[model samples]
Target chain A: MAFLKLESLRKAYGEFVAVKECSLSIGEGEFVCLLGPSGCGKTTTLQMIAGFVEPTEGRIILNGADITRLGPSKRGLGIVFQSYALFPHMTVAANVAFGLEMRAIAKRERRERVAHMLDLVRLDGFADRYPRQLSGGQRQRVALARALVIEPSVLLLDEPMGALDALLREEMQIELRALQKRLGITTIMVTHDQVEAMSLADRVVLLNNGSVEQVAEPFAMYEHPSGRFASTFLGKSNVLAGDVSGASVLVGDQELPADLAGMSGAVDYIIRPEKITFAAAGGLVRGQVTARVFLGDRWLYQLDTPVGPMQVIDTNVGLPKAVEGDAVGLVWAAENARVVARGAAS
Target chain B: MSRTPIALHIFHWLFVLFMVAPLAVVVLVSFTDKGYISFPFDGASLRWFQAIWNQKSFIDSFWLSLALGATAATLAVVLAVPAAMAIAWHRFPARDLALALLMSPLMLPAIVLGIAILRLLSHLGMTGSLAGLVAAHMVVVLPYVLRLVIAAAAGYDHALSQAARSLGASAWAAFRRIELPQLVPGIAGGWIIAFVTSFDELTMSIFVSSAGTTTLPVRMYNYIANTIDPLLAAISTVLIALTLVLMIVLDRLFGLDRILGGKA
Candidate 1:
């Protein structure tokens, strides 16, 4: 059985729905990320799971027990916030000892546990220091230590690295993932950043407008998105509109073999930018390079074709360079494209 | 910038002199060795200070004011913090109306409130009592405490409380651990201002004080009415010194800017 199951969980504020009938089952020790843009209900769903928000409908089953109506305190869950909400007046040791104090642990044990938590977060000597004295990253670590010290059943992180700078954010993402792995805690994170989701989550749940668009492993979500929103949101893609004819697709005046089955009259075909290559001789479609942008390791070229403008990414590998307004042939393997139904665009 | 105009300079000096001249006169008269008040150059002595110390009534009234002010300020804070938190966090029906009602005392004239309380206390047969005075003072001081605490609560990061709740803290525990500590500066500031307001209050005390229950301000007013002695000057000097000390203490506890302007 899955460790945590959210069955048709719905959260609404007045007439506005923040999260629709969403159901997800996460196995024990799985690190899942709810990834979406702002107002996409990822945070709302996370809050519902954390018990900070009461879902308007549906049940929350954790370890086969219904906890839908349980208060946040009664539900044993640890949460790290975006702002790293460490108690400003308390010392690092006192802040870490708070959870144990609430649990009514013995003084000596609480002291030892606090010390151990401080050491775990690599702030052993800074136990007596106030939170204001610590840097953003150190404060974040303190928050992590404070939450993890509680030894709760599930861990929830809401945009945990959102407040850090770019370099520090990336560093903390790696550190957080490593820490979660070491602890083997069932973790769920809500993040709008796709890169962070891809780097940390075992599975990413893509949400759009209060509904789940797709839920899959990072690679699968990126390579084979079920909808336009999912494909575009997971990573960069070149989307082209076309009509399918048997095993081929008609794009304006050019007819190309369809990569996948079940594509109907009108469909949106998604191809990763990196998949398209420049061909000199025989190719699927002939086009002219309209624009070229050098992006350090690679060159991003926009090709004007019979269908539309197709974006292609190429590594700067000493190939005969294609300049702007230069005639070029664009080609990709038949298996590189994934056709999604047009109705799923929204 | 060009040199300030001569007329503007004179006006600036006039304004400064207007502000400082009365205080300067009080200080000079306080040190006068003569039996009565005088201005400018005075033969300075500690004789008036000794005379003021000789009176037991002034000393008793001073302590009484201090005790009442302290008690009222403490009571105000105890009442205001939770009210402020409730006002900040939840939106109950008529919340704004309730806030406006609680704050109405601030806009009302102090003498009117004092007279109204006196009439009510007389009806209840509780007039001329210490409890009555403290209760009346609480009414006046409550708005300041509530205003500061509300500002503090409003300024608090709601996410912090949510984070605490999500981390297994009960609602009360989360507020006690996360929200309350952050509000300490504002609460302290509110307490100080309330104490000072009650301590220096004169108009309200005039209407409410009985013979033995007269506060320092009422006693001071009566003393000044009867005699223009340097003894009164000495008392005024002491009050000024007390106010300065209280302000310094408040500044140390919670920055003066925060207390005066409701900025945390």
Candidate 2:
């Protein structure tokens, strides 16, 4: 059964539509990520769910209750803001105990819960310290503890790790994912970082221009994007203009077999960089490597091919396979290339 | 990090002397042993300071001024907090105009304000009432309170309130727990400034106060008009000490730069 449902949710500011007809059904305990670039309405959609924003039109049903008209305080959802939003004047224990106090829980019970939550977030020793005294990662943990100590039905994270450094961000991401799994609370996170979304979410909902572009598992969305925006936004992709005839796509002079899904005229063939390889002899197409970038784990080669400008990534096992200015044949599996209708936004 | 040049260092000391000369002269005059205001006295005595205790009007007026300042400052702060929050957080129509109206007292000449307030109080039959005096003083001091609180509100992280609400705190609860504590420094600083401004007010208080409700400043003005003595100088010295103590407290509780410089 669907635990939370948003039906045709739309939010408009004057003539600008921030979220246009968004609809989704999330199951219980599912970790969903709203991934998109800035101004893509991912944050707006999350805000609507959290009751911070009221939709211009539509209904929000949570746990079999129509909560579209509910106020944020009445919604009882846990939210971690991008700034962490810890009370600067309050100690860590007092900050975490705030929600419990709001719920009118007994003082003894609130103290016990606050202590347990501090221990859970591994800040047991620093409970008396204020937020300004803690490091960025420690502050982030305190915010999480404050939110989760309420035992809310849904947990919402709005780029909670945005303030942390790259290394701290990764460490917190692992800790957050592990914590979510253990609690089995329905969690929704909004982030522009695709790598973070892919690593943290069970399902990634890609949005563009105030609409959902694609909703799929991380691997499936990356492999089979529905349109041009999704194909490029989730990860880098090489797009080549092509003509479809029968079961093959004709680009330049090479006819490459692609799953066109029947009706097609001018189409775009999308292929991931890692899917393409540097073939030594007699391969799909001939190209010269224009630029080569070593990305630690992979060698990224920018090439001028007969089809168009293309990119290929090869794993860095030992040494360089193809350097800049080298003539190389680019080859990929036929199933790896995807064909989509031309000029489609999503 | 760099040493002051000889010329600039001498200029700084001269500026300090220029500012303190009047107050220093007043203190020196208060210690004179002569009957009148004389530069070179025969000897130093504590008689002028003792004279302040013997004067009933001055003693009563001193307590009245303290009560009036504390009351007016507290009232101004109470009204300014909500006004500052509204002006800082919302985008309602005439927000800037409302803020300007609250702060207009600062721009208006004190004599003009005094005459206008005196006319209103007379028509309302409240010219000599304590409430009338407090209301006039609140108007003078509100701008200082409002400006600091507005600055604090602007720099506050509004997301903290949202986080509280999301964690199931109602609007009132969130304000009490999350918003009020964060604004303490601004409130305390504004109250101190308001109290000092109200205590030193003369033009407006002179217009509003009658014989029964004379404040210490008005009382001193009347006494100086009647006689020339070091007794007034002794009272002035006491006021100077009180102001210094308040300034030190303000600086210790909240950094002077953060409060007066509006650094938030």
Best by DockQ: 2
**lDDT against true structure, model 1:** 0.87
TM-score of chain B of each: 0.90, 0.94
Going through the candidates in order, what fraction of the true interface contacts does each contain?
Answer: 0.74, 0.94
Residue B59 accuracy (lDDT) in model 2: 90
Residue A149 of model 2, lDDT score:
94
lDDT of 2 by residue, A276-336 (tens): 8878887788899999998999888899988888888889999899888889887889889
How many residue pairs clash per model? 0, 0
Interface RMSD of each: 1.4, 0.8
Q: Pick the candidate with the highest TM-score.
A: 2
TM-score of chain B of 1: 0.90
- Cα lDDT tens digits, model 1, A140-163, are 999999889989899999999888
lDDT of 2 by residue, B1-264 (tens): 998899998999999999999999998899887789988677999899998899989999999999999999999999999999999999999998999999999999999999999999999999899999999999999999999888888899989999989988889999999898778778877887898899889988889999899999999998899999999999999888887887798689777876676554
The window of 10 residues in a row where model 1 chain A has the poorest summed lDDT is: A254-263
